[model samples]
Target: MFYGVSALGRKWSNRSPEEHVRRWGRIAYGVSILGFASHVTFFITRWIGGGHIPTSNMYEFMTFLAMAIMFAFIVVNAIYRKPLLGLFTLPLTVIIVAYAAVFPQEVQPLIPALQSIWLKVHVTTAATGEAFFAVGFAAGLMYLLRTVDFKKTSPQARREQRWVEFTLFVIVVIIAFIGSVFSFRGAGYEATFKQENVVIDDKGIESTTTETVEYSLPPIFKPFNSQDVLVEPFLGVKKPLMETPSWMKGVNAARKLNTITWSIINGAILYGLLRLVLRKRIGAAIHPLMDGIDEDDIDEISYRAIAIGYPIFMLGALIFAMIWAYIAWSRFWGWDPKEVWALITWLYYTAYLHLRLSRGWHGSKSAWLAVIGFVVVMFTLIGVNLVLVGLHSYAGV
Candidate 1:
């Protein structure tokens, strides 16, 4: 709040020197410093209490990522002196922290595979590198909002406007999704399914077992070949709309799908309400505040942050990841979903840099790439864990 107010005040001060908002800006920076200190303290205490670095699971990893983002934001803001950077960066931090809460918070003993220093090093370093990419994302998105023309109804401008609006909508979906999860959880909503699977051994012996899955959200999709052991009705709906496809090979696929469904439904409804009230595209609504902002500085921030992050990402996500994988699984790469996606993310930024430097992709084109690159990063981070069962499956909810 202080950062936001101070940024706005700084804007006002720029327009009218009589406002004298320097005092407020200093106070905001001080509070931000204090907040970062507290965040680090939490990390230290959690590490000490857990007897392991807290990057073992979704909750711990996301919190650590959020802290890294703040750390990056502080560094960038110090260098750039842009209070408005916090307007984008801090909200992203809050959203990530809130999204982390959607997962179970219980602390569990580390599995043997995770009991390695390499595992800790790989996760932390990778998250730190991704944090810089996230800062780049924030700046890139701000650049779009600042430069995209809200009033030009020409075809190209209209296309840009729609994509920008879509990006904002995705953010809303995340927020609404979190709200939906906690809302149902707080109301004690519960449903369970029983899935049966048959496994054949080397001796040609077949064994069947039933696996149970639970859902806090209404089950829009249930497990394949599963029966409702118990279902708590929501809004008069007692059964799932459909079953998860058999091709989806994850134990948690159904629950994850249902959660996504709720997020979209909730997001659409909330977005609709907001659109009606604002009576404009969300990006258009926001574009006015960015009127006097410099797009070039934002572009530079986006590029520099990504430039710094790419090699770190290469080091941690790929190099250290391969080392850890070799140590744990006796192979550097087995084409695990997580590993594949991390490579995809790295390739994406590689292309972004290539286009920016070699092919002359600049300004809005570069910004768009930066924005989409983070989406790839997010899928590599959260989406893979949620939708794909892999060696890193235990790292997720």
Candidate 2:
């Protein structure tokens, strides 16, 4: 709604309508504030219900990310008074919130590894830092769209530009796919599978037992020992086209693969629809909206956001995370996928800072770095947890 109102406000501004644009803009801002407040209330409520801070799982972390994005946006807008910032930032927040909503929302008890007090401190601070990074992503994207000279680009450059825009469109489609899956869950979609496990006893006697497991989403691939007997009749395909390898350790590995497959399929469909409607790349479609905004201001906001976010991210994601790991696992670094990715994120941003400050990389170069930095952040936060199996896999819940 905030995004729609902002767009409406922009459209009305062209006709010099009677205060409607400004009124809608203020209302949109108010809605975002309300969203922040609602997130706060939800966090407190979950904290009270679960008897811990609400950053222990994907649902909680994503909600925190949404809150942090709004908080950062409100602060940035207050300083810059750039209503366009809201237009870019809020959509990203909505995507985060929507993706978060796809996860199970039921609050569960924290696992043993997550019971430490540092869980709250470490995770919340990291999320706050990444939230600011998200702001940088929005600003950097706006800067690129505003300043890039697409019309004068070479043929090869235009092809590369289309690919970049398609990638962004794919990201949006992935979010929408998650949202659609969540909706399907609400509509009683489920897939059930039967598996037979062969067990060897101490006496060398072998026994086989069969068990049935149900999944919220269709499994695109069945486990080696399992057969999907029933699947919700949706998406025109009932059974997975492939079998999950036995080497995949997780019980839900097949389901995860299925979800990824479906997301790609759905995303492709949405991308086609977007292309058909716009008759141009998504980035090109959005370029006109940045007409009046100053590229330098956008560039500086991106840089300043990174400047502010880097230290916080380092302190929380790296320092605090390492300390917590030591206390919990009695090790400084265990090469857990999450920990390694966190380190990679830190190093990436560190490199971004060095390039900007020392090499005088500014404008498009800096902005592109900021944009890529957020991609790393997202992978560390979402991709690592979802796609990779490691000590932090519990957080995917």
Candidate 3:
């Protein structure tokens, strides 16, 4: 809360006298350091108490990611002294910490496969690298808001404008997902479904198994092949409105689909409310705050951040990951969904760097690439883990 308040205070302080802005900046920085110190302390104590590194589970890993992001922010802020950066990164960190709450928080022991020291090195370094990429995303977004010509009616400009709006929409949807999860969770809302799937072997022998799906949020879409075991009514709605398609494959596929449906419905409503309140597109509403910011500097900050992160990401997500993979499964690469997505993320940033340095992809083009790169990173982290069953599936839980 203090971090968020300090960020907003910095925005307002920008219009004040130089002395006042400087004073407020100092206060904001101090609060940021204090918050980061507390975060690190929690991390250390959890490591000691849990008898292992805290990045073994979803909640622990996400909190670690938030800590890494804050650490990255402090470093970048120290170098550039950009108070405005806090306005975006701090809120994102808060949102992540909240999103982390959606998962079960109880500590679970590391499995034999994940018991190696390589797992710890792989997870921590990957998170730290992704933290820098997150900073790049924030800076890239700032560059876009700082430079996009919102008033231009030209086809190209309109395209850029719409993409920016969609970016804001994505952010709003994530926030909505987090908000709705907590709201329903607090209300103790739940629905359970039982799914039966029959498998036929190569010899034509068939077997049936019953699986269950539990939802903390109201089920908007039930499992593909399932019947309701229990559904507590919400606002007189007793049944799910739809069913997940067979194409959506996973043990948790139905629950994931239902959560997505709810998030979209709530996200659209929340985003519409924001539009009505601001009387403009959220991007246009925020564009004014980019005034007086140097676009080149913002672009440079984005590029430099990604540049530093790319190699670290290479070492951790790929190198360390491959080492652990070999240790755990006797293979370096098996084209698992997670591994494939990690490679895709690496190549995407590799392309970004190639275009950036050689093709002179400087300003908005580079910013857009940086922004899109993080989306790939997130899908690799959250989407693949939750939606796909692989060797790394346990991480999703």
TM per candidate comes to: 0.93, 0.89, 0.95
Tell me the spans in candidate 1 whose CA falls farther than 4 Å from its real position: 7-23, 198-207
Which is the leading candidate under TM-score? 3
Residues 21-56 of candidate 1 have per-residue lDDT tens digits of 455656777777888999999999988998988888
How does candidate 3 score on lDDT?
0.88
Point out where model 3 deviates above 4 Å: 1-17
RMSD of each: 2.2, 3.1, 1.9
For model 2 the local lDDT of residue 70 reads 89
Query: CA lDDT of each candidate?
Result: 0.88, 0.82, 0.88
What is the C-alpha lDDT profile of model 3 across 43-116, one tens digit per residue?
99988988899898789999999999999899988998877788888888998899888888887898888788
In model 1, what lDDT does residue 49 have?
Answer: 90
